[model samples]
Structure formats: C-alpha cells, structure tokens
Target chain A: MTTSRRQHTLEVLVENEPGVLARVAGLFSRRAFNIETLNVGPTEDSSISKMVIGVAVEGHSLEQVIAQLDKLVSVISIKDVTGKVKEVHDTQPDYQN
Target chain B: MAHIPTANGTAMTGATSLVKSLEAADVEVMFGLPGGAILPAYDPIFDSSIRHILVRHEQGAGHAATGYAQVTGRAGVCIATSGPGATNLVTPLMDAAMDSVPLIAITGQVPSAAIGTDAFQEADIRGITMPFTKHNYLVTDPDQIPGVIAEAFHIATTGRPGPVLVDVAKDALQKMTTFNWPTSIKLAGYNPKTTPDAQAITDAAALIAQSSKPVFYVGGGVIKANAHKELRQLVELLGAPVVTTLMARGAFPDSHPLHMGMPGMHGTVAAVTALQKADLLITLGARFDDRVTGKLSTFAPNAKILHADIDPAEIGKNRHADVAVVADVKETISALIPALKAALAKNQPDLSAWLRQMNSLKSTYPLGFDQPEDGSLSPQHVIQRIGQISGTDTIFTAGVGQHQMWASQFISYEHPRTWLNSGGAGTMGYGVPAAMGAKVGAPDATVWAIDGDGCFQMTNQELVTCALNNIPIKVAIINNESLGMVRQWQTLFYEGRYSNTNLESKRVPNFPMLAESMGCVGLSCERPEDLDKTIEKAMSINDQPVVVDFRVHRDAMVWPMVAAGTSNDEIMIARATAPDWDSQEL
Candidate 1:
C-alpha cells in the first residue's frame, strides 16, 4: 500500500536567542527531511519567537518531525496549522494569496 | 569551603568551579589530553578527585568517553583545547550523536578578546560541533561556568541522551568570581515527556493480545532506559518472539527460547524472516533504520507497527506506526506489560502455531560457519573461542566490517551493556579506545575488543594509553589480511576485482610488532591449535594491555548476509564454495 505525502504547517514557539533557529534547522537537515517554506516572527511574548515551517511528509514522518521539534530546549510549543488554515481559507471567498 | 580564599564568602577561579561542577555531577573519572588553550582548566585538575586519563589522540579520548558512558549508563566526560584539539573530537561526537550515547565534551576556547580575532590556537568550536551535539554553549563569563556545566550534564544525561559541548574561553577559566552553584534550572522548552498516553498504551496492548504472529523489534533505547526486565516480562506475557537490533544486542538475552537473534542486515535468517512475516511489530526504542528495514517498502509488509520510543521523531520516520507511544522506555514498557497481561487474560491469541513456524525457521537456518579443514584459521572460530573462554559477562567492543559482524553474531550477550560497537556510524578504529573506556568505567568486568586487521590499524595507538593507565583489557584482532566486508561485497557485486581493500601482512604494518612497540604484550596465533592458549595467556596478564592477533583466512566472509536494498526474506546463507580471488594468492 502506498502512503501519499501531505503538506503540513507547524507553528513552533521558541526562545528568541542566537543559534535557536540553527538548532531547529540542523535537526531537520540531519534527518534528511525537506522544508518547503519557513517564516520566523516575534510573538506576543517578546521573549519568545514564532516559527512557521511548512513541509511535505508522509503520515509517519509527520509525527516524527513533530516529536523531534518538541525536543528542542528553545522550542516552547508547537501547533499543527495545516488543516485549520486550509479550512479558514476555504470559508473566506475573498481570501487570496 | 575551607579551600576557598575569601574571609566571609570565599571566591574561586572559574577553573576550580568547573572541577567542582563535575564533582557535583558524580563524575569519578574523565578521559582527556592537556593543551595550551585549556591550560587554565588543567590547573584545577591536579587537586580534583576525578582521575584524568592521558590519551595519545583526541579521538581516542572522545571514543573512550563514549565507551565509559555505554558501560556505566551515565554521561561520560572528555576535555580538549581549541583549534586542532577540539576538531579531533568531532568524529566521536558525531558517532555518539548517531548512537545516542550520553557524553559531555568540554573544550577551552581562545580568550574572549581574541575570539573574534585570528589569534593563535583560535577556533569557533561551538560552531564546529553545533550540528552534531544535542546542545552546546560558549561561556564568556566565569559566573556562567557553574550553571553551564550543570546544564551540560543535565542535558547530556536526559531524554534520548547524546553529546553536549561546552566551550569556555581561556579568560573565563582564569577569571576569579564568587562560586554560587545554581541549585535549580529553568529551561522553559527542555522538558521531556516521560509518561506515554494511556489510550495509546491500551491500543497497543489490545493489538498485542489480538495478534498471533507478533514480534518485539527492540532497539538501543530499551537498553538506554534500563527496561530489559520489562521487555522480558512483556515477551513472556505475550508469548511472542523478539528480534533485537544491533544497537539492542543484549536487551533481550540471546539464550532465551523465544529470542530470535538480531534482525535486518547481518542478522540471523530466522530473526529477519520472523520480522517479515510478523502481523504485529512492537518496536521499542528503535528508529526504523535503513539497515533494519532493507528496501523499506517491502519490510514487514503485513505488519501493523506499534512503535514505542522516547524520541517521537523515530516513530514515523521510516515506517508508519498504527500506535505511537512517546515516553521513557522503562515507563512505556512497564505500562505495556500490565495492559497486555490484562488483555490476554480475557481472550488469549493462539500463537503456538506461529511459534512453531519461527522455531522451524530458526532450526533450519541457524547462524553457522564452516571450520577450514585445511588447518587455516577461521575468524569465526577464533571469536567463538574467545566468547566461550570469556564467558557471558565479558564486554565485547568491535570496530566496523566483517570482524564486527562476526563478533556480534558469535558473542552471545546475556546482560545489557555487554556489547559496545559503533552500530549506526559504522566507524572503524572504534574498538581499542572504546575498550579502554569500558575497562576504565567497569574496572571489575572482563573487557575484550574484537577487531579486524584494517580496523585495528585505525586506533591501535590507544594501547599505549591503556598500558600507561594500567587498564588490562585484552584485544583480539581477527586479521584477515584485507578489508573483509568490502572484499566480500566486491566478490559478490564487483566481479571479484579487489582494488585497495587488501591489507596483507607483507605490505601493511605488522600488528603484533605495532602492539609491542606501544607497550602491549603482543601475541600472534596463525595456527588454530594455538588460539586457546594464546587467549588464556593474554587474559592472565593484568598489569598492562594485551593484543592477540589471529591471522585467519583472508577470504572468509560473514554469512547469513542481507545484501543492501534487498528484502530481508532473501537473506543469503553461507555459500558452498569460496569465490575466485584476484592476483592475490590465497
């Protein structure tokens, strides 16, 4: 049976400090996983930053990548925005790129 | 407190505090070499309770630390200076990361003022070791030394253990400050989930109770979590077989009736076939490595995988798990056993027929090798002899290649941490230094290193370190006169054209002589009859290291081999006749 790869958007909250992004990116690179797009921005809490990363992963690898992202000391929390964002965009008729 | 210089609250140098921090971590020994940039850190070492081993190469120090960690189930510490000294440690750090060994590597960087400048002996070691380490820090202030050191140990030892690097500036070590050890840590994002989800455990238990052809695919995490007892209990409760991976060699005792030997590449035929035919796979603490799941698509095609691991990343990385439990391995396994027992009490699955099938496969294709009737020594015979003589408690360390695979197959491990090899990285030259480290960590255990001619030549310099430290570890080099594994592959796949794989005695450095020059008692056994006596003589000597070189047949290959990218079902058993050799005389 073939398992199709699906696009996943993960929003990770992390400590705003030097090398934190490198730490997260390093893990993905080492595991040989690909990142489709990534964006980092300041969150409500100035001490913590938000990183949104999008990637195509099979069902199993998605769970693994989420688990690995949780292990980083700088990562505060993670939320899967893949299905939620798609739903919100589908409801809004004027929603554009 | 009495040793402090201050009248009211004593102040101390960062170097002194660093040593105190290591003491707080309950470190009894450290493996390292002294250097200029790390000179300040060395000053306090003279007064500390920790014993520092002087290694010939920094790589030796690194692997030695990894060995210590593997044996003691604690974080092993190693030290080095900036530039080349720190760079030499990269390989072991990478190896430890891949294998998830707990290690703490401390390096002395250039002075803070000289860090950015092109100063002598300057290197951005933090940057160099970043990708490989689980966590790392560069201490600029002496006040941060105690806290950083504390966190380094905490990070190194906890949750899916791996190496942690701490680079201290030379000035930071020399600067004097009030010593206030941080009693508490507040790393907001660093907590590990140790308790698995209750529903997931239940789901797994139900799956275990429902399936007849169930197999426990155990990995290194089981050993790391010290959950062997729980694993054994679960296996008994479910009445299923277990196939321990290379990393999980001793997690399940090989002598057990239901134990299928190691699975995947180089694994026994029964173990490989059992995994392929299994309906339920309870994978504990192991990532689905490419080695274990050859041609991943065809691996365990009929099985619904239940992966229980501390690292969530491992669960679905290679194969999709129907039930995923992320928690401490001991906790997860302990929870699983009771649930499975309870589930089985209601309606037990009849696994007797499945067990019979597995046993039949086991008996039909048992791990075997033929003894050369021509009086030529076989490496397998030599290793099996060592295993028989040393008994079950002897810890075996091996370098990569044919000798490593032979050592794994021949040596039967009954306890955890008895087999130490570079499994994931497949590193050559890991045997000697790792054996030295294992001997140092477990002083009372009989530590033996089984190495190949090609692998032994990689890090034999550590024999001097072993001799100097009075670590009496025995090393048996299965000298086949060439890179046996690669040659075997060349013979099978490359049309028998051996290129640069040969390490014949006439061309290469003499192993026995090299061992002798390094202050070891070097013994060679070319005749099969002399193997037992030579090993006994080597084992009797306790004052220094002993090296026994067993020159076996150059072409003897590791049997029951699973060619890379092939299904485990098609494992190649021993060939009836030897293949053709090139110009080299047999």
Candidate 2:
C-alpha cells in the first residue's frame, strides 16, 4: 500500500500546563512522524489553550496518530482542517464509504 | 482514560498523565537535574519508560541532551527546576539554537502566584530565552499541556531547526486535566518548503557553469538537514573543490578529491588558499560565523558567494551573499543537482594548478606538533595518537572553547555524527557527559571526550555517573592551567590584565583523587615524553571511565585568532605573523 502524504491543520483544545509542549512534540518526534507547522496560543479562558499542528501523515499513519492523540490526558478536542486543500486525490475513500 | 497514572487523583495534584503523554511522544530519555518546583515531573518520570539520567549539574543536562541529539539524530530533551536551575540550561539552549540542533529545554517555574514576587529561585525564564529559542511558551494551565509540548518539539526540530523552551509554572503541574495528544499542528508562520524553487536552482547552476574557479563551502546546516547524499551529488556535479566550516565537518566525505578540508580560523592552509582563489563560492547550510570567516573582506575575496539555508534571518546575517537562496539545504541541493545534470555540457576542467598549490601547503605544514621527546605531557601528541588508535569509528566529543576548536581543526571526523561538541553554545563542561551519552547510545563504540581544563572542571562531577553506570569513556584533558581562550584574548588584546581567567592553583590538582572519590580511574600526563604510553593506557582501561590529564603548555593559544567585532577576514595568524616557532620538525 502506498503511504498517502497530506498536510493537515489541526486546531486542538488543551489544558495549558508546564512541559506540555515538550510532552506533545516529543510525541510526534518519538514516532518519527513529520509535523509541517505548529503554533500555539491561549484562548479566552486561561485554563484552556488552542494548538494548531500542521503535520504530514500517510493515510495509514493518520489513523494510528489520531487514535493515539484521542487517548491523551489534557487534550480537549482535535479537528482536521486538511479539507482546506482543493479536493485532492481522494485520500482514504474507504473512510467515507 | 483512567490508564492515566496519577498520585492520589486529588484536585491539588496534576496528573502524571503528562509524563504518560510524553511516553506516547516516544521520549525514551531525559537529561535533567531535579529541584523543588519540578517535583511533579519527577513523580511521573520514574513510572514512565523515559529514562532520566541525573546530571551532576543543570548545565550539564543541556549538554548531555545536545550530545545525545548530535549523535542520535533526534531532538534532545533537557529539564531543570525554576530560577537558577533554568538559568543553567540557557548556555546549552543557545548552543543548540546557534547550531540549529533540534533541542527542547523544559524548566520548572515558580507557580503563577510566586512569579514576579522574588520568590525563592524565581526568574523570568521565558523572557531570558525569548531571543535565544526559536519559540518559547509559559504554559498556564493543565489543558494546554499536551498541545504546547507537541508544538515545542515541532518548532525546535523543524525548518531551520533550533532550540525551543517550555517554562512550566508550578500550579499548572498541580492541576488535574484530561490529556489529548495532537495529531497535527497548524502553524501559519512556520512554512518550511522542502522542494527548492526551480528558477533559483537554474540560476545557481548557471552561475556555477560559467565560473572558471568554483568552490563549495559547506557547513552544519547540511548535516542537520541530513543532506549528505544530496550535497555529495551536488559537489560531484559541479566538479569544483569544496571547503567546509568547522560546523559543516561531514557535509562531504573528507576523502573526496574536490574536498579541500575546513577553512577559516586554524583552517587548513590548502582550504584557506582554495577559498582565497575561488571565483565562485557555493555555500550550503552554513552561517558565515566570524571564526569561519577571519577577515570577512579578504575571505573568499575573489569568489562571489551563493549562500543557501532554511533560515532567512541567516541569509545576510554575517557576510552579504551575492545571491541568497533561502531554502532547506537538502531541497536546494536536490534542485541544484537536477539543474546541473540538465545543463551539463562540459567535462571536468583542469584544476591542476590549484591542486598543486594545495598539495604543497598540505605537505609543508601538515598540522604536526611534537613535545620534548621523553620529557612530559603533550595534548596534541595524545590527541594525534588517540586518532591513530581509535580509528574513525570511535566517536569524539569536545568541550568548548580552545579544545573544541582544536579538535574540529585536527580530527578527521568521517562519520556524520561522530564529532559532537558545544559548537554554537560553546559550553565548557559539556565534553564528559556528552561522551557518556554517546557511549550510552552506542555501547560497543569507543567514545572519547576531549576537554580543556576549564571545560572539564565545569562538569567533571559527571565522572561519578560514568563510575555508577560503569560507562567506559576515555577523556583526554588538554589542561592549560587557565581559561585558555579568554587568556589568549587577554594576552593579545587585554594587555595581559590577567583578571580571573587563571586556574593555576588547580593546575596540578589531584584529579585521580577526585576520580577515586567518584570510583573512576584517572591518569596524569606530566611529561611530554610519556604522552603516547599515557594515552594508550587511558584508552585501554575498559573497567571504568578514564581521564588522561595532559599538562599542555599553559600559555598555548589557538592560532588564526580573529579579534571580536572585526570582519571575518581580519585574522591574526601566529600572533602577528612573526615566526614564533620554527617550521622545521623539532
């Protein structure tokens, strides 16, 4: 199976804490996955923060990464903005079906 | 997900899930020193698979992590407590930042309430690290923990990769929060294009084809980007000679015909001559650091430079590039390779004249030093002999300042990550522990930590770690009885004011006693005559880490010294070009 590479923009809700950034990227780097862009900032509530991670993942790797991310302790939400790309070659038509 | 490891699950105590989250990130190692504010981090550290190697000093933690990253090709992680602890990590972070190493430094901060209140050991860590780090965050709440860590690691090892700082406040670690790792990030400002621009590649190729005397001045950027294969292809395509900066040691195979060795301060005479004669200079992944440029105007004077790097800030930071292509080194080289192939029409031109001049310089000077035969210790002779015995596979790590420069100039590091040092950060006490870490990474390989007296003393306490772990590392101490580089400056510029730079009192300190206290063996090299046997014995002892203290000349200085703030070209060779020592072999 060919690994489909796509850049996805994710806006995540997180609990801002010490060493969280290191914990987070240490996640991806440890997996040896590639993150293309990443920026983080606080939201209205000081307790909550927003993280945007632009990572390149193969179709196979995306499912594994997302499943692992869903299991994090501080993550509130994860939204994929990769649809921002023009209807590129159908990535994982199996997911839609 | 109650799989979250928590102590008591109380509202006052934050979850160890953050550490668990780090495990998901695959952080197998953490080099840090513990302190009061960071207790929560330690609580979970023991539970996670992530091994925490306690460095003797906080500064050493950063160096250890940097050394780890340098050899393993991974983002190095370091942690420290609030205030002084955090401050200790700054030099190493700056080194990682300067050299574009993928480094993440996490420090504990006084709780938000204690901040700005002159609380015990409280300092504005984020503020101090702002300029040095590629990005930094003062994590405020438990919810923000996972995302911030993800971003920190991402920012550090990406694009023009550098160090990233994450200062965690005390309260945040005490709060309870659910963890969710980030699967992706959306950083608009950080767009790193891996593919080179077609037009610029074509333009660069055109510049190369027309120039009669072309040279490749490669640097560390190429190594960081893992572009060795592409760089070699580009060099071969251009059929021109290549000269690298100290930081760009392994960008090209040192054995290649076109490779002219390193240039700049203490640079090879051949490489320096080649840089002076080249008409077209193709620089890759290197900043024109002053040490590498000597007199800037006179440097590559005849050559028009084509500078390429991922960081745009470095495009014209030191010397103005005739043409600056701001792109990743690998991308730029890949593009250039194709362009050159497409535009290839001529075979290799005759570089016989240039080669002859370089060959003559190599044979005449040949970077040799001899101590009074059968008299005492010579660091040069020790290092040279070590190089001969260790062969190329045995990796070498050096502490800053003069010893590092000397190692870079003299050692032929054939392996890509074989030579590790505090290049940009120039941390003195980095060698011992970094060598310790290198040995840990590759257990079977012989690891040598080459250090100066100034550097060894800084983190020499780590000698105990080697003893405890029984990590057999051979250390060659080039003890000069002073902060030799600073003293060198004092001798040349400061009119020998002789302020606090001297370490004469400790010149003959009982290093073996110090090592014995830590359960490690130490050997002293007092006679320049007994240098070879001392080195051989040090390298042979596999029982514990060994220290070979070579009592080098106290007044010794690294030649080709460039005065600060001067152009890279304005260098002082041999302290005013007068023959201080005869060129003849003693």
- On TM-score, the leading prediction is 1
- Cα lDDT tens digits, model 1, B504-580, are 85346777788889899889899988989998988898888899988898878888777898877677786533212
**Candidate 1: segments with Cα more than 4 A from true spot:** A1-9, A43-46, A54-61, A82-97, B1-9, B576-586
In candidate 1 chain A, where is summed lDDT lowest over 10 consecutive residues? Answer: A55-64
Model 1, residue A39: distance off in Å is 3.8
True contacts kept of 1: 0.67
Model 2 TM-score relative to the real fold: 0.80
Which docking band does candidate 2 fall into?
A: incorrect
**TM-score for each candidate, following the candidate numbering:** 0.93, 0.80
Tens digits of per-residue lDDT for model 2 on B273-320? 677777877889888776677666667777887888776656655666
TM-score of chain B of each: 0.96, 0.90
DockQ values, each candidate: 0.53, 0.02
